[model samples]
Target: MSLLENILYFQGGLGVLANMFLIIFYTCIILDHRYKPMDLIFCQLTFIHIMMFLTAGEIWLADIFESLNVKNDFKCKATFYIYRVMRGLSICITCLLSVFQAVTISPSTALLAKYKHKLKQHIIKASLYIWSFNLSFSSNLIFYVGGFTNVSETNQMKVFKSCSLFPINYIIRGFLLTVTTSRDVFLVGVMLTTSTYMVIVLFRHQRQCKHLHSISQLRTSPEKRATQTILMLVVFFVAIYWVDFIISCMSFLLWMYNPVILTVQKFVMNIYPTITPLVQISSDNRIINVLKILWSKRHQIFKKRWFFCLL
Candidate 1:
């Protein structure tokens, strides 16, 4: 294998491992109600991340090993369709998580607070809807995506391996692209607006606490910490997502002239999903405590071994 391909595979393998860790962590959170609504959403988000990573990993493998390639048009279409569906669902779920937290931490008298009572139930229903809608919408992809086949002048047939959207009627293609762009734009808009709202709410609350000389009271609250974590998640997600989007556009415009641009786009695209679990753990006291206990046990074992060696 080429060095670059090996590096790509290594990076993808790391992403798969990190996503697995997150899946386990989220599963622990979901099995216990102390974590509640947010944990449920986190679990779902982790699952989506795993799917995205696995699907992308498979594509990379197919690129490397001809035996693993998509052998037929149906497989190509299905692979592309599944990846797009998962990607769309990921965006929608993240947006939902952000908005849910924003509403959860809103002031009791605020209009958004009215829905907070049943937000847990709403989260379940929203998750189901997001999955169903994304799957249905992405089904449109099957009509235009497939493995390309070319026949050479020497009378040999070559089947291109990658899953790609084949060009269709211009109007139909444009419509599909428009629908996709609209969905992304809408979800991103909601995420930004809700995250910004939470920041404003947090700032105002901090100001009020300052006026009352109770800033410490506000700072110590779980809600305040969650607000900060979600805001940070949003910042990381937006930064990586838009950069990937721009790179994707550039790659398309350049049309195979620069392979490096597409590679960079893929790298950026995976950044958010790969690192999100670490972001979550950083702000989660429960997860941190568990990690500390595990670390202490490992450290104690190492110390005992060293003492025995000294004796």
Candidate 2:
């Protein structure tokens, strides 16, 4: 495999592993009934990222479907469709996460405070709606994508190694593009607005803390840490997401899918998913404590084995 291909595989592997770890961690917290509201959001996001990697990570679905004797066209359609759905969910859930965190941190007298209780009660319902919307919104992809034949055709736009987008009626394409763009713009606008509100809230909270306590005496609350983490993720996601969006738009518009450009886009798309779990693992005290406990148990087991061997 080429260096680019090798790098892609490594990235996919790392992201999948990290996401799996996070899912398990959140699952444990939920089972113990010690989970915060954001834990549910984090778990859902991790699951979506895992699905995205499985569908879009080069060769993952291709190899599986090929082994199953699936038709190439069907494989292409299913793979692209699922990838798009998961991609849509990623943005939607990320936006939800930011909004939820902003609400969580809002002052008691703030307008968002009244909705905080309602948000927690309706989180599951909101997630279901997001899934339903994205699943339907991306239905157009199934009609437009097909297995790419080796023969060059002016009408086909190759998006993956095995999948190309079939030309559709210009009017239909324009309508779909408009709707997709609007949905993305609206979600991104919400994310930005929430993020800005969070910054203002954090600033005021910090000033209040300074007045109440010395710098050395102050410690970060769990809410503050979580908010800061979400803020970091939102900023990073927005940056990476736009790069992928621009590349995808240009490729679709010009019907020019350069191999290098495709590879770079894939790399950019995977960045947020890959780093997200690592950030959560480092920042969350609960996950850290769990790791420490597991490590201590393993160490004790090793010591007992070594003593038995010596005896």
Candidate 3:
């Protein structure tokens, strides 16, 4: 590989690491009640990130054409369909997570509080609905995406992959683009709105505690630290992903006029899924405690299994 390819491959490895951490986190959340409401969304997000990394990694780490040989129509269709569905679902889930988190911190009297009780249960149903929804919606693209053999006038020709839908009944292309654009707009709005709510609530929380000793408030207690970490995290994620999504939307929407925008968009677009794993490990005590608990349990299980074998 060239230097550029090497860099891409290394970055892909980091992406895998991020995805792995998310898998561990999702697994922990699944087995615990503290993050019950977040379990479904986090699990789905983790799975999506894993797929995103693995598939994208193939482009860099493996033979782009040789190893990824879309050997059959089925493989081609599956790859396109799966990636689109997962991408849509990832954005959708992140938007939901942001809204849910914001709702949770509404101080018990905000009108949004009324919906808080249903958040956990609603998440389960919503997750399933979203997967099914995106899957069904994106399935039509499969009919247009295929690996077909082509013939040329050279008297020596091989399979030349091309889209069956390009120049593509402008109507259908328009429709697909519209659906995708609409969904993006909705999710972006959700992210920005919920993120704004988080900012407001967090500012209020900090204002209330502003008089306390800085060291005492920021470092002395686990609860305060966790809350502080989460608040900071809200700010970080909202700033990063929301801006990314906005730039991406503008890029795609204006691609006809400026194609290079995709290059600008790809950096942020690709990394959004990488956030779930790195979320607060550097700051959030709750996540750290969960990781420690999981590590201890894993060790205990290994010891027990070995002891039983000896017996």
Q: What's the TM for model 2?
A: 0.92
Residue-wise lDDT of candidate 1 within 208-276, one digit each (tens)? 999999999997998899878888888788788878767654433332323455455566777888778
The TM-scores of all predictions, comma-separated, are 0.84, 0.92, 0.71
- Residue 255, candidate 1: Cα error in Å is 5.8
Candidate 1: which stretches are off by over 4 Å?
1-7, 59-70, 148-161, 250-258, 299-311
Q: Report the number of the highest-TM-score candidate.
A: 2
Task: Judge candidate 2 at residue 240 and give its lDDT.
Answer: 93
Local accuracy by lDDT, each model: 0.75, 0.88, 0.61
Top candidate, metric lDDT: 2
- Model 3 sits at a Cα RMSD from the real structure of 6.2
Error of 1 at 80 (Å): 1.5
Note the residue pairs that clash in candidate 3.
none
Query: How would the candidate models be sorted by TM-score, starting from the highest?
Result: 2, 1, 3
Better of 2 and 3 by lDDT: 2
| lDDT tens readout by residue for model 3, 25-138 | 767767775565655666777788777665543343234444666455555556556666777777777777777777766778889889888987878887778878888987
